[model samples]
Target chain A: MNSNWHEEAYYTIRTYEIDSKKQATLPALVKLMHESAMQHVIKLGVSVWDLEPHHISWVLMRQQLSVHRLPRLGEQIKIETYPSGYERLFTYRDYKVYDAAGELIAHSSSTWVLMDTVQRSLARFPGFILEMLQLAPAPELCLPRPAGQLPKMEKTDHSLDFVVRWHDLDYNDHLNNMYYLQWMLEALPDELLNHGRLRAFDIQYRAEAQWKDQVRAEVQHLPNGRMLHRLVRPDDGKELALALSEWE
Target chain B: MNSNWHEEAYYTIRTYEIDSKKQATLPALVKLMHESAMQHVIKLGVSVWDLEPHHISWVLMRQQLSVHRLPRLGEQIKIETYPSGYERLFTYRDYKVYDAAGELIAHSSSTWVLMDTVQRSLARFPGFILEMLQLAPAPELCLPRPAGQLPKMEKTDHSLDFVVRWHDLDYNDHLNNMYYLQWMLEALPDELLNHGRLRAFDIQYRAEAQWKDQVRAEVQHLPNGRMLHRLVRPDDGKELALALSEWE
Candidate 1:
């Protein structure tokens, strides 16, 4: 897909954006995607004024991102985004990341929905939405599949439980989505988390948890050298999330 | 507002939960809240069995909370949350926070919206949602006023424009929300933020910002000894956020 409807912006890499590992953190990437999306929307002239009096806000439902090469400390990166059009209820966008010389480092696709703030309903795409999107035809968004699915929930046997801590919260008072991926990986033994590399994984958020809640995480190793993970509440046996991870 | 509900849960504060200022960090609070809410939902019968197939997720829309007194490091806080009924579009929940000795520390109100994960649409309340949430009687949610609007955007009237650094980014790519508050407080003349006592104020998240994005923050002294702060993207002249801060 191709169209003239495209714009490019540049951002500098800052020291604070890097984590203890000295790499840009995944949460930072999530934040970047959000800001970039907003910038794209603003370029389309859909400011807060474009929404109805009732408040219109963007809510992240689910995201699947892949990082082939992470930018190093003090390295500058350029991120480009294009509207890939919409699926039934979601507007799809694709992103291509490059280093200073334009070497491809990552590619991603995200689905977004417009919401009615007051009625708390899914808002239909206003004509201005297209206008706000300033749609430009772009290459189809092709994201790499994370590792395949592990067996059913019963297959994963060993499990761990943790109490929700005050620091685990976000502005919304829920576990930040990216934080869960960390927990999903952290549940693995130190040998796996420390030496093993995260080849790929798929995580599905099942329910929201709050402070002081007890959460249970279960893990299993497959003969194929992959691990299956699940998080739940042991007291009532509530499953919070599930993921299939492969590491070396 | 008073509550007759006998809800009780103890949250053990962790060291990571404390910010540079030695206070419970707000992002951590958000994570705990997510766990708490999920536990509540599970108890209401919305289990993994009911959640699969349809990927559904909830994101915070808006929240109003007041902190009377923040807990010291390692303090175990008890937080009680009860449904406060629904407003125009949000499922409202109210929280009562207590210190180890049972002294009230803060009261907060939060609003949330559910979304269809794959479709990324504003998903209406599932049939079981109201039933599940309504298990507890509606309690009073004392709403807080918006923090004083940040003073009008100016050329930093003696301020600094910071390009967000990597370290500043959390798992979420955009600058951490708490950092904004911290930045606002930091921009204040050392005379203020360095004070020993923390009084009260309410802040709201208007939008997310990116790294290397130049932020211009302006601080003005309000007539009542409070401060008005505005953070703006100078390159595009867009207001990223605003805050009204008061201190003792």
Candidate 2:
């Protein structure tokens, strides 16, 4: 039985929680929500051993979250999550984030897909996981998908290169998103982010690159100053990932 | 040719940069230093692709950094790094971190190994890398060995479990050290981190883990209140990493 049940699990907020708006950053909030999901899965006893070698590890395919209210720094909040079943290619998980007084602050849902680690091939959820985690079949919850397919590159006229560093590799021995974002943002013309602030960003992971691999991320500057960034595989023209960022 | 041989690079400090001492944390500093190294390599055209895939990859086997001072919130720092040369089992890289006034605040050197990513084996640096990047042989430069090993864990009877998340994974889909440190620190029984402050912490990476991997970290408390923490694979009980944290 899951020991860390809802009646026993709770998380407290720290003074360092707020963003420049004096509210929590979406990225950080997403992190906490993800943590809550992990806690829930652990409570259910689903672990690493259940993983298959062909396991295409789950990646955050897409997420849609809406905040009815924002929690201030130092405000203790509670989170509850539940499995909402799977679709053709994605497993859905839903969350409700609440403040101490039991007021709902935000509600979110995300889609994830398991992929073969080495081959980078997509994989279906294993039946054992579905039973071990007690993730019973349920009707899929509805949420809006990210608009359009990822913007394509018209051309690769120029590129910026980046080296893989030891610290750059995480426990999975791949690059971290924040640092990857940092590199992509840094590669952009500084004036763009030099005095500006990042409003929102959405990135999709396409493939994994190893430590010390030489990578060239190409950027396409649109007329409006927004950018479509592609992290490319120089050995093959495989587009490893795409990122879209908006700044003001 | 490195076209922007002298073009200045920039980075901003966010609130997350501060550690328990309210100073820029060492791991974060190492991350920034690594970022500087990547930026430098990208500008030099030896970015990721120039690397040999199977036989050679860079692993930060060890690092030794000395900081004369630390940066506070809202601070912007500039950094520069270059390849110093190679030693027997490691490649040496050096860095200079400066404040806004161009005052040098930190000087660091790190030792990295060329590894085979797929087989998890070490490889020798290929000759083409040195030639293509116009790097000269300077085997004299080497990273100073770390002062001590992670204190051995004597508290084998105790264990703490944590759920892993997406934010915990970096671009390569591995958990970042900062998050591991965050987990280790956060797991400190609460009474300690809340009452006292963390003075210093040094840890070493022994192995890498994937996303959703359940981790069990054990801490050995000394009579004087110092702690030795060890993270282990939940199943086979292999030591993943270890750490020592001093509190006041």
Residue-wise C-alpha lDDT for candidate 2, range A49-75, written one tens digit per residue: 235354545566655456666566446
True contacts kept of 2: 0.00
List model 2 lDDT by residue over B1-248, tens digit each. 44443224566554345443335655566667766665565556554433544345566654545666767644688877666665565666667789999998877666567677777787766665554323522345433435566556765534566544333454344565555555565456656743555555556666776655777777778656577777877777767677777666
The ten-residue window of minimal lDDT in model 1 chain A covers: A138-147
| DockQ of the candidate models in sequence | 0.03, 0.02
Write the residue-wise lDDT of candidate 1 on A41-63 in tens digits: 55565634345453764444444
* Superposed model 1: Cα runs more than 4 Å off: A1-21, A42-57, A115-123, A133-136, A139-151, A155-174, A206-218, A223-225, A231-241, A246-248, B1-247
lDDT of 1 by residue, B123-199 (tens): 77777676655544634334442224345544343454555644455433567555666555556675464343445
Q: Worst 10-residue stretch by lDDT in candidate 2 chain B?
A: B136-145
Q: For model 2, what is the C-alpha lDDT against the true structure?
A: 0.59
Error of 1 at A157 (Å): 5.0
Candidate 1 is graded, for docking, as incorrect
Candidate 2's error at A215, in angstroms? Answer: 37
TM-score of chain B of 2: 0.71
